[model samples]
Target: MIHTHEVVNQPPPREGVDEFATDAPLVEAVARWGRAGAVPPLSEVGVHVGSAAFQRDAELANTHPPVLRSHDRWGVRVDEVEYDDAYHRILGAAVGAGAHTSAWADPGAGANVDRAAAFLLFAQVEPGHACPVSMTHAAVPVLELAASGLRDEWMPRLLSRAYEPELGGVGLETRPGAAPRPAQGGGRPRVAKRSALVGMAMTEKQGGSDVRANTTRAEPTGADDARGREFRLTGHKWFCSAPMSDAFLVLAQAQGGLSCFFVPRVLPDGSRNVFRIQRLKDKLGNRSNASSEVEFEGTTAWLVGEEGRGVAAIVQMVTRTRLDCVIGTAAGMRQSVAEAAWHVRHRSAFGSLLVDQPAMAAVVADLALESEAATVTAMRLARAYDDDADDAERAFRRLATAVSKFWICKRGPEHAYEALECLGGNGYTEAFPLARRYREQPLLAIWEGSGNVIALDVLRVLDREPDAFDAFFDVVGEAAGGHAAFDLALAEAQSIVREVSADAAGAPVRARELAERLALLLQASLLVQHSPAAVADAFARSRLEGDGGTLYGALPPGVDTAAILARA
Candidate 1:
C-alpha cells in the first residue's frame, strides 16, 4: 500500500545549541567584566545545565509538583512536603556547582559576578528551585548579625555544598565533627546537620508588601543566654515559599516592635517545631517549588537581630534577592530569544527560511537587542556588588538595583510573548519551553516587590540618599560623552530629577514614569559604552531617542538587523 500520511513541513528540533559553547554574549559579558578566571567552571556548569539529561529532569520536576503530607500514616501532624526526585537532583546540581554559596565561600574581586553568571545559567534550566538557592545565599548576610555562638553553629552547615532534603525526626543524628549544641537555658541540644536550606516568611494576609502591618506576635520565652534569646511566635504567613527548608527568616511583632527571628523546622530535642502547613499554594507557574500558607502556634524561634529593626536587618537580604530577580528575568529573555532564533533559522516559509525574511529578521533583531541590553545591565549590577566597600559604588548599587529590577522584570512577559509568536502555534503548547517561560516571567516582577513598590523605592533613594542620584548620573555620564541620543536622554532624566525634587507631593504620582526613564537611560548608556556599534546605535536611536513604536520589531530604517541578530 502507498503511504498516504507524512509529517512534512515540520521543523527539526532546535536542540544542539551547546548552551555553554554557543553563547557569545554570555562569554563576552563574563570576560569583559573581569570574570575571565571563572569561565572554565562556569562553562562546565552551563554545559551540564543545558545537557539533555538535566533538561529532562527540569521538566519532570515541574510536571510533578511537590505534595504536602499533612500527616503520616499514623495520623500525626508532620506537615511534611514531598517532592519529585527530579527536584532534588536539580537542586543538588545547583548546590554542587556552588551557585548558592560561591560568593561567600570565596570573597574577592569577581566572585559575585562569577556566581551571578553561574546562577543565570542554572536558572535557565530550572527557575523554580532557584528560590531556595537564592534565599540560602541571601540568608548569609542576615545570619552574620546573629550572636557569634549562633552564627558558628549554623553557618558551617549552610555553607555545605550538599543538598539534604531529610527533615529531622526521631533518632536523627548530628553530622560528623559538629556537636549538638544546647538551646538557651541548657535545654536538650538541637541536632546539627551537615547541610541546610533557608527560606523567608513575610507578607501576612492583612499586609502584603506592608510588612509593618503584620500581626504576627513574637513573645520572649524567658530563656536567655550567651547563645541567643528565644521567642515563641504565633502568626500566619500568607505566602511561605520553600516550606521544607530547614529554617526561615520571619518578621514578628515583639515588645519593642517588629523584630527578625530565625524559625527552624526541627527543635533542639530532635522534634519538629510547631509549624502547621495549612496548604500548598496552587501557583500559575513554578510548580516544581512549593509555596505554602503556614500557621505558627508558639513556634520555637530565636531573635536574629534587635527588636524594632526587622526591616533594617532584612533589607539587605531583600536587595540581594531583587538582584536575583533581575538576573532571572534576563535569563528568561535569553532563553526566549534563543528558541525564537533557532525556530526561524530552521523553519522555512515562502520559499525561504524564516530568518532570512526581512520582516521576521527585524523581529528577531529587536528581541536580540532587548536580551543583550538586559544581560549587560545585570552584569554591571553584579560588578557593583563586588565593590560594596566603595562609597560611590554602594550608592550606585542602591539606586541602580531598583531601576533595573523595575524595567527588566516588567519587560520580560511581553518579550516572552513576542518570542513565542515567532514560533507560531508550536510555541503556545507545553511541548515547547517558551509557554512555560511566559508564565514564569510575571512571578519575578511580583516576587520581591511589585511595580509600584520598586518605582517608589527609586524615589525613596532619591529623597533619602542624594548621593545615590549623583552616583547614578556619574556612572551613566561615563558613557554619555559621544552619543547624542544618550546625552539628550540623560539631560532629560536630570531635568525630571530636579523637578521631582522641587515637588515632593507629586513624586509618587510620577514614580513609575520616572523610573522607566531612568532605567532606559542607564541601559542605553551601558550599550553605548560596551556593546558593538550596531547594537549600541540601534538601541540609542530607538529607545533613547523615542524613534520606535510600542511593539517589538519596530526598529527604524538605519538599524542593522543582520548584525544584531548575528550577535544574538
Candidate 2:
C-alpha cells in the first residue's frame, strides 16, 4: 500500500530562493531605475518573503479569514476585527521591511523604486496583507497636505516600520526627536517597535466609485485647534478595508459639502471611538484582510483639507494607491509565471518535459513576456515618482499610471487563468497558489477604479493636462526606430488619440479603446527601449502587430520563445 501510494513527477516547493535575485527583470528594472543600492536589502526582503515560513503564514492567514468581533464579553462594543497570528506575522514582516512608507520616509533618489520593488516581492507571496500596506503608504501624501498639525503628531508613528496589532493599546504618541531617516534598517528606530496602519472609507453602497454620492454626514463640533477643525461624523460606510487599521481617511458631507476627515480608532485619551462594525464583507478573495461595513455614530473626527474638497484632498492618495494596483497586479503575474514555469520544468508529461514541448513553451514564454512588460512599466512609473523627478517625468507619470493601471490590472485575471492551466488539476485546488491568485487579480482592477473609471480618467488628463499626453508620447517616442510593429502601433495610437481628443463628448465611448492602445504602446515602447531584442521583438510582433490571439500560447511564428522563457 505504501509503495502504491508513492508520489512522483511533482515540482519541488518554490521556496528558499531569493525572489528578487531570481527575478532578473525586477533586478534589472531596479538598477535601471536608479535603485542599485536597494538591491541588497531588496534581495534580503526577497529571501524573507519567499521562504517556506512566509508561505505558510500566507496560507494560514487566508485559510483563517479575519473575524469581526463587534462586541466583547459582557456586551462591550469593541468594533474589532480579530485576525489570525499568521496575518499579524505577515503584516508585521511587511511593515518591518518598510514596504509601506519607505518612499516617503527616505524621500530621495530611488526611494520610491526601492519601496515599489519591496512591495512587489511581498505582494507576490501574500497580496491580502498588501491592502493596509498600500493604504498606509498612500495616506502619507494626503496627511502632509490636509492636516499639518496632525501630520506632525502622526507622521512619525505612521512611518514606523513596527506593526502594532493592538488597535487601542498604543497611544498616539510620537517619540521625541524622531524623524524620517533613510531606508537603512527600517529607516531608523522609534521609541519602541510601535507603528500605525491607515485605512480609507470612501465608497457607499449607493455610490461605489462615485464617492460624491456618499450620504455620510459630518457636523462641526465648534472646536478648532492644532489638529484642525473638529467634527462628529454620523453615517455608514459601505466598504472600509483594513478595519483593524488605527485610523482612516474618510469622506462625508459637511456643512460646506463633501469633506475629508481623519478618524482615529482610539482617541488621545486611549479609548475606542464610536465605530460600529456592522459586518465584514464576504469577499471572494483577499480573505486575510478585513473589509467591513461600519457605522460611525457621532464619531469624533478632525477635518482634513478644506470643507467641500474631500475629493481634491485624497487625490494624491488615490493616485499612489492606483500605482500600487499596477505593482500588485504585476507581482501576481510574476508569481503565476514562476509557478507555471517551475511546474512545466519538473512535471514531465507524454514523452518530454512540458517546457520543451512547443505548445507549452509558447504559453510560458508569452506569460513571461506579459509579466516582463508589466514589471518594466510598473518600475518606470515608480521611477517617475521620485521627489526630484523632472517636469517631463511627472507629466509622464500622471498619464502613464492610469494607462498601466487600466490595462495591466484588467489583464491580471486572464493571465492568472492561463498560468493556472499549465499545472492542470493541481492549479485549481487551494493547495496551489494560482487558484488564490486567480481570485486575487480581479480585486486589483476593481480596487482603485474599474476599467471605465480609469479610462475616463485618462481622457480627463488628456483634456485638462496637455503636457501629460505629450510627455507620454515623448517617452514612447524614444523607442520609435526600434521596431516596425511598434512604430506602426504608436502611429495608430496617435491617430486614435486625435480622434478621441477631437470629440470630447464622444470620448467616453471610445475611452476603453484609447486606454488599451496607449497601454500597449507604452508597454511596447518600454520593452523596445530596455528589454532584450528577443523579449522586445516577440512582444511587438504578438502585441503591437495585432496578430496575437485573444489567449496566451499564440506568439507569432518565428518568435524566440526560448529567450522569453529564459527570463521567466
Candidate 3:
C-alpha cells in the first residue's frame, strides 16, 4: 500500500484515475474474501516466527452493506471521535489512484501485504460488510502513534483487533549470540494487537538510512490535565508512508540511544494538536499510499520503553515491514509481468500476436528469470527467518526481519521494471498496470530502510562475524576472479567504499551507497551461481548499467527505462 522512496518525483497515480475499469474478478475476490467471514478471535490469530499467513480474514460483522471495516479497531466508532480528517480521506485516495494506473499487485507471497491492504480497501468500501479484520493488533505501535498526534485530553482506547485467520502467519528468524533479553520484557504487542491491522508505519529518510543516527528525538513529558497523559517527541520525519493511518510507530533518539514509540494524531479531548500533515507530496508510484513530511512540535507522546530503547522497540516493526515490502512489491511485478505476457500472447501487433515477435519473447524470458530468482530469494529469507528465530525470539527479534526485508523489498522493484518492459508503450501508460506495479515495488526498497541501509545491516552483522563475511567474500572472490569485467567493477566499487569510509566530515552517504551496491553484487553472484532463476551475468549487468549489450538487441525496443528500473 506504500510507495517506495524512489518514487518521490512522479505525480501521484491517484491524480489521474478515470482511464480504466477495475478488474471485476479482483474486486470480486476482495468482496468474496470480505464476505466469507472474520479472521478469528484475537487470541486465535496465528503467531509464528518465519512464514507468512497470507490468507483471507475469516469475516467481520456487517454494518453497512459496504463499509470501511478495519479502519478503526476492526471497526472503532470513528464517527463520534474527533481526529484529523486526513486519515479517512487517504483510503479513498488509494483506490482512486489505483484505477487506470499500473499500481496494481498480483497474487503472490511477495505481495501478501498488498493483498492484505486490498482486503482492507474492500472492507472499507463494501456497503453491507461493516466489520474489518484485526491488522491493528498487528500494528499496535502504529495505532498508538496516530492517536498521540491528535488530541491531549481523552481516555486512551485499549483496542482489540481480530487475531485469527492471519494473512501470512508469523514465525521467527533469530541470530546466534543475540542479547539475552529485551528490557521491555513483554512490550511486544500480542498477535491480535500486531501493527498490521492498522496498516504499517515505515521510515527511511533520504540522508539517514543508517537508522542508528536518525535525527528524531523523544523526551519525557510530565502530565498536564488528568486526561492529558504526558510524553514528548521533537523531530522532522521525512516520510510517514501511510500518513492517514490510525498510528505511526516512530523512531527517535533519547538519552540512551535510538528507540521507537507509538504516536497518534488525536487526543481524547477532541483535538488535533501535536502533529500536522505537511504535504501529500506527489510521487512516482504508489500514489495512493500517501507519504508526508511531518514536524513534531514537542508532540505529547508515550514511551514504549526506556528513553534509549525507541530504536529497539521500533526495529521490530521496521524489520518485519522491510521484509514484507519485498514480498509485496515482487508479487506486484510478478502479477504485472504475467498480466502483460498474457496480453501479449493474445494481442496483435504489426503482423501477428505480440508473443510471436522475437523481441517480445526475449523480454518475457528476462521477466521469467528475474521473477524466479526474486521468489526463491524471498522464500529463502523467509524460511531462514523461521529457522533462526525459532527459540531466541526474545532478542533475535529483528534477525529474520531485517535480512528478508532488506533483500526482498529492494529486489522486488528492481525486477518489476523488467517485467514492465515486456509490454512496450502499453506498460508505460496508465493503459496498463505495469507502471503502477513498477512504482509500488520500490516502496519497499526505499522505505523501512533504503537498499543502502539494509546492505549496511548485512555489513554490520558481517563485520562482527568475520568468518561469515569471509565465507561470503570468498565466494565473491572466486566468482569474480575470472570475470575481468565484473572483477574490475566490483573492486572499483569496494575501493570507492574504502575511500568514502575514510572521510569523516560527510562520507556516510557515499559509503552507504557503496555498501548497498556491494550487497547487490554479492546477492547477484549468489543468484547467478545457484538460483534456478539465475539470470545471465552479462544480461543483468547490461540491464543494471543500461549498457547496450547482447540482450539489448534481443529485447523489445519500446520498453521504458523508468519502468524497467522500477521493477528492480
Candidate 4:
C-alpha cells in the first residue's frame, strides 16, 4: 500500500481526556454548590464520555439515525421505532451513571448540581439521547404531585439505573387486533425492573405554544381508581419526541378546561395502549432521537393535578426541561471551545503554531469566556433546584431559569459557528464533530419554548411573581461592585427592569431586550463571583461594556487572552 501523502500539520484526535477534572469552571462550580463527594463519581462519567469508544458511538448513532417501523412484516400494527445499537449503548451509559434521576432518587446536598454536572458531561459527548434523558428527569416532579398509587407504581421504575430500551411486557393486547382497555390492573400492578423514560406531547398542529388552543379532548372513563381520574384521550399530537418512551405527559381538554394527563404506552393490564405513531419527523438535527406525530384513539390516560389545571401541572416539567436546555447549551459551548482550543494548540500555519498566534488565541479565548459564563450560570441554577433550597433560592430559579434559557440557548448557534470556523474546512465536514454541534445548538433554543415564548414568560414572572423578580436581582447583586464594567451593566439592567415594570403594556416590545440584559447580568455576576480574574474581566469588557465587535475574537486590547485560553 502506497500513501498518497503523509498527513502533516493536522491536529490529533481530541478524546480520552477526563472532561470533568480538566474543566476548571465546572469543577469549581460543583464544589461551591454541589456536594464535595459528588466529584469522584462525576470524574468517572467524564472518563467514559471523553473516551474514543464513546465518541465513536456518538458518531455512529447520528450517522445511522433511527428508523420508524409502523408495522411488522405480518402487517400487524407494531408502532415501533428502531434505533442504532450505538444509541442504546449511549443511553445505557448515561442512565447507569445516574444522570437521569440522581437528584430525586438520592436527594441530599447539591443533588441537582451533581446530576446537572453528569448531564452536562454526557450531553457534551452526545446530545441526541439527552432529550429522552431530560424528559425523564423532568418527569419526577410532576409524578410526585400525582396520586400516591401512580407515584408509587412509577417512581421505582423511573428511578432505576438499569436502561432497557424495549417495552417488553409493558405493551397492550396479547390478542391480535383486540381493543385496548385503558386501565385494569387490580391491586398493585406487576411493575418491571427495567428503567423507564418519560416523554412530552403538548403542541398540536393548531396551537404551538398556546396549549389552551389545543383541540384534543379527554373523555371520562367513569373509573375513579387509585391512579387518579381515568380518562380516554382521542387526539393527534403534532410533536412527540422519544415516541418509544414508557409514558408521556400529555395535554388535552377536559370538562373543566385544558388539563394534563399521564398517558402510558402500556396499560397496567400488561397490554399495549392505543398509541399510534403517525410518522417520524424529518428534523434538521437530533437525528439519533425519534420525534413523531402520534394519534391517540381512545388512549388510556390518568389525570395529573386537578381539572382545568393542565398548564399549571405541566409547568413543572417545562421548567426543568428549560433548565436542561440551558445546561445542554452550555455543554455544547464547552465542547466547541474545547475542540477549538485543542485544534489550535496542535495545528500550525505560517511557520507558527495556531495557539501561539495572537489572532487564533484571541478567538479561542473569546469562545472560552462564553463557555465559562454558561457553565457557571448553569451550575448556579442547578444549585437552586437542590432539596434544601429556601424560599429565596426557589424564587431566584423561577425567574432566572427563563432568563438563562432565552439568552444562553440563543447564543448557542453563533458560538458553535465561531468554533467551527476555527478548524477551517475540517470543522464543516461530518467527519468532524463541530458540524453536528452547529445543527444541535439550535434545537435547545426551540425546545421547551422558543425565544419569544421564553421572553414573555420572563415578563410574566416580573409582572405576577414580584418575589421571584426580587430574588433574581438579589442573587445578581452579590457581584455588583466586583468589576466596573459589570457594575454599569447591572445598573442598566435594573433601569430596564424598572421601565418594564412601569409600563406593562409596552413590556412585550422590550421583552427580548429585557431577557438579554438579565441573562448577561446573571452570567457576568456568576463569572465575577466564581471565575478567575482574567476570565471575568475579559467577559465584562467584551460582553457588558460593548467593547467587543459583533463576532468572536473581538476582545479589548489589554484583556488577558492567555489566562482565558489556559482554562480552554
| Candidate 1 local lDDT, residue 191 | 58
TM-score of 4: 0.95
Q: Which tens-of-lDDT digit does each residue in 237-283 have in candidate 2?
A: 99998989989999999989999999988776555678888999999
Q: Report lDDT (CA) for all predictions.
A: 0.87, 0.90, 0.42, 0.91
lDDT of 1 at 414: 96
Tens-digit lDDT track of model 4 for 166-277? 7643422446555534323322222343568999999999998998999999999999878899999999999998998999999999999999999988777776688999
Per residue, candidate 1 scores C-alpha lDDT tens digits across 431-494 of 8888889889999999999999999999999889999999999999999675888899999999
Q: Could you tell me the TM-score of candidate 3?
A: 0.53
lDDT of 2 at 566: 88
Say which candidate scores most in lDDT. Answer: 4
Query: Against the hidden true structure, what lDDT does model 1 obtain?
Result: 0.87
Please give the TM-score that candidate 2 achieves against the real structure: 0.95
Against the hidden reference, what TM-scores do the models get?
A: 0.95, 0.95, 0.53, 0.95
The clash number for model 2 is: 0
How far residue 494's Cα lies from its native spot in candidate 1, in Å, is 0.6
Better of 2 and 3 by TM-score: 2
TM-score of 1: 0.95
Error of 4 at 423 (Å): 0.5
Candidate 3's C-alpha runs over 4 A off are: 1-207, 210-217, 222-229, 253-258, 267-273, 391-414, 465-568
